[model samples]
Target: MRLRLLLCVLCWLGTTPALAAENSRVLTTIKPLQQIAAAVMKDIDTPALLMEPGASPHSYALRPSDRRALAEAERIYWIGPELELFLQDLLERQDSAVDLLHLPQMAVRKQQQAHNFQKDEHASHAHGHEHDHGSLDAHIWLSPDNAKVVARYMAEDLASVYPQHVDQLQANLAVFERSLTALDDRLQVRLSPLRDKPYFVFHDGYGYFEDHYGVKPQGIFSLSHEVQPGARHVNQLRQQLQAAGPSCVFTEPQFTPRLVNSLTQGLPVTVGVLDPLGSAIDVGPKGYEHMLEDMSGALADCLEAL
Candidate 1:
């Protein structure tokens, strides 16, 4: 079931949001989302990025300056409370913000990754992410299909708000669709071989990508990023890793704690980097594709070496 947005971002293209269209500044919560909004608002005005690249939404804290960004922008977009816990209260105090997670067309992933290795086990201890039970996974922007839905939503809403820029926004959406199609095809072929390759992640934030590309990890080190796994649990994970032999362990760029290095030490595993937020990629019309391509490349490069 789709949870309602506190301010009903569901009606972003409605009359209320369209009240002020002239020079309305748009803001997006993260880099991936900023990239998509940029694509739709291409050449009109670039949407400001709220969370910088390489920052984990799970741990981000909203600042007074960020509040100024929120107040200044006419439209703000973000994944809902499940992911960006810090932004929930702030959004409740305002109406200009829209929760992309609440979009009706969104393809929400209720549970974590659908991995065969985790069916019988309680990976809840050391899984990728431990969202509240039955809560939606807020990484909705990772899937290309979902990306299309977002791009269209942005176009439709922006067109309604700024009727003068309708043609340009529609054209931009057309180009974005074409580019996403090509990216999706290439990813299908690129990640095809590595789907069955056993792997693990420091965070289970990659469910959308994994499910979309058919790449499932063996298991994860910890489910809650905020909690430290006990020595007993760590040893059990190490034993499981030793049994698997030469697989890869992917770590996110934002949080590469010393615990990760200690967990994989002396094991027959290659520790690789996977930046979910695409910290190094430039935010632009093609930024989303570059980010995903880099992620796929990182996975393929690390897994193939083993």
Candidate 2:
């Protein structure tokens, strides 16, 4: 009986590393997606992020290391051809690539055009970057409802890859849903008072959050981050701010153009920073909640100050 027990223990130790190796093959395109993937994979395995914290998905050029990571990844999650145009061609060829935007469960919103905002026809000459605004906004992760959908799909996808961890993944998904529900309840209470507060975002990317929380923005300075706001657009935003009265103008961490200061100058507007990518927040199971909380705080701080 002692010899039989010793043989069984040795066999179990031999296969443990193989199981761990299988579980660590997941990859996500951005920090927000990584946050959801990490939550679904809590304690089982951590997914790798394709884009670095400060990198702009609007105009990212894939590095050689990124290519290698893509080649080695067992499964890749991205928003699709709209947001990450750079990866569209390459991902199209990869069978393991999964476009989250294309998922039927995801609730998508159309990108809103800037009001009285004309396209910067000479933007390419000045900025040297092209902008392609897809009909749908790819920043769906901003909405907590969308995050729940993403987490469910991630759990399902990971379960298929590592069936041995299916039970754990399902438990993680349950925890995520519960936590999201609690967070949403708390946020609704906190943001309820600020619903009528009018503000302006530098980019039109926060429509999902604004719509979900009933936070209204007077207007957007630019539709695309890659394209700098032209003189005409800046003047138009200034006019809106003047007409709308004292309001806040929020800029993103990734692209706080110098024009923001110029546009808000001599006006009763305060500048606030909103980071959609959660660049400053640590990446982990609770990162997504932290990101949303930070955004809400940023909005409340500036809008309430007025």
Candidate 3:
């Protein structure tokens, strides 16, 4: 009887760490997804980011470390094939991974094609699963409403994996929703004044944000960050800029091509930087909010009257 009791105690001790490890291994594909996951898993487990800052998801290849991270993770959250193309095959092998874009609750927007730029000549050579780029804009996190849906979905998945922390996850989701609501109200007021102001973005990625906030973008220079606009397209953009006299032209930190300088060489438009991936922002519970606030500030700074 004594021997049997001792073996039971030893087995219980050995299983504790394994159980803890199972519950704590949450991973996200990008920083923004990490930010949302971190917010939902606050005080539970800090979700790890797969793609480091400054890396473009459109063309990123998976490192060995990323493969290991995916294997070890008990729960994985990502924007799906349209965004993180590198993860498609690895995720197919893992049935547990959650594709946030496929969630019925998520309000997905269609990808906006570049107004005058030609179709990608290398579209066939593009890596990852064949994504319908025209069908959906996988940058769903840009919209606060979509972020809320993602947070709720994350909370549900986290609760299932770590049942002991369900209460905390639900609580975190509530707080995130409230914070998002407050931020939306603030941004609406701040960005409303710039509704009529015209601007140009380097790429069509900002459609969701622009549509959500009613900000005006005269046009986009490229359909995808990986693709460059042709010389004729650039000349057309120059002519449009000359005629419309846009308040600003926004370029992303990930791609500050020389073309932007060429477009505004003698124009009155102010240049501003926008970071859609939250690449520079530190990942935490409030990272998503900070990203939206920063974007709003960038827009207002350039769009407001001098």
Candidate 4:
């Protein structure tokens, strides 16, 4: 009788874990997507994020460990080939067991060229150096509207995989949407003064942000860290910056400031940095909201300084 009880206990223990594992396991590409996945899987133990702090997904090469994690995850979400160029083949080859959530699926907007950041004399100035890069701005999470779409998708995915959590996922989605709506209202009011304002960015990742807020960026100095502006593009941008006389020209942390310095030379413009991602500021758990707020405040401060 005692032996029978022990066997039954072991069987129950094994079955419980197997059942739990069958419920859900998610892995996302970036920190922003991690936060979204976290909200959707609020009831889960923990989800995984592929990109780490200070890691550049633009040119990140996958390690063997990364491949193992991707193969193990139940679902994985990312902005698509624009950023994860290296993962394209891996994703395609992924077994049917792993679910892939490509954000730019049926709702993909027309793609745009990345911002330019190369100086006119980039090639000549390289001290025996050559750099090759092909990446468009993959910072789609910067826009609140896009965030809403992703949040909704994440919630649906969570519910679909774990039907028992359908109610919980629905509630989470409503809460996420409400938070986004509140953030959007605050941003609209805060950025109202600068709605029609002409500005410039070190990179062109702000197109969605600018479009949503009715602001027009004067020009893109660089697309990603790897892209450099050619001589002709630099001259054209220089002329535009001079003509527009934008209040501020922004740069990011990951890239060089060489292009920024060259473009703003002899031009009356204050240089500021806008982090489309929440690296510079402590945006809190709601990092997406924090990113938008920091950007608005930074732009406002720059404009007021002028």
lDDT by residue for model 3 (1-306), tens: 999999999999865534433444887888888899888988888887777788778778876556767788888888888887777888977977989898999887787655454434422222222345577888899999999999998888887788999999999999999999999999999899878888887666777788899986877655334445466655766787888764688887755456567668888788899988888887889999999899889988888863
Question: What does candidate 1's lDDT look like per residue over 145-217, in tens digits?
Answer: 8989999999988776578999999999999999889988988997898777889886467878889999988
lDDT for each candidate structure: 0.77, 0.81, 0.78, 0.64
Candidate rank order under TM-score: 2, 3, 1, 4
Q: State which candidate has the highest lDDT.
A: 2
RMSD of each: 10.1, 9.3, 9.2, 9.6
* Cα lDDT of model 4 by residue, 108-209, tens digit: 344344324334544322211222334344557767777778877777776766888888887877887898789889878877787656677654467677
The TM-scores of all predictions, comma-separated, are: 0.83, 0.85, 0.85, 0.74
What residue pairs clash in candidate 1, if any at all?
127-223, 128-204
Models sorted by lDDT, best on top: 2, 3, 1, 4
Worst 10 residues of 2 by lDDT: 122-131
- Clash totals for all models, in order? 2, 0, 0, 8
lDDT of 2 by residue, 82-190 (tens): 7898998999999999999989988998876554455465233211233345588888999999999999998898887889999999999999899989999998998
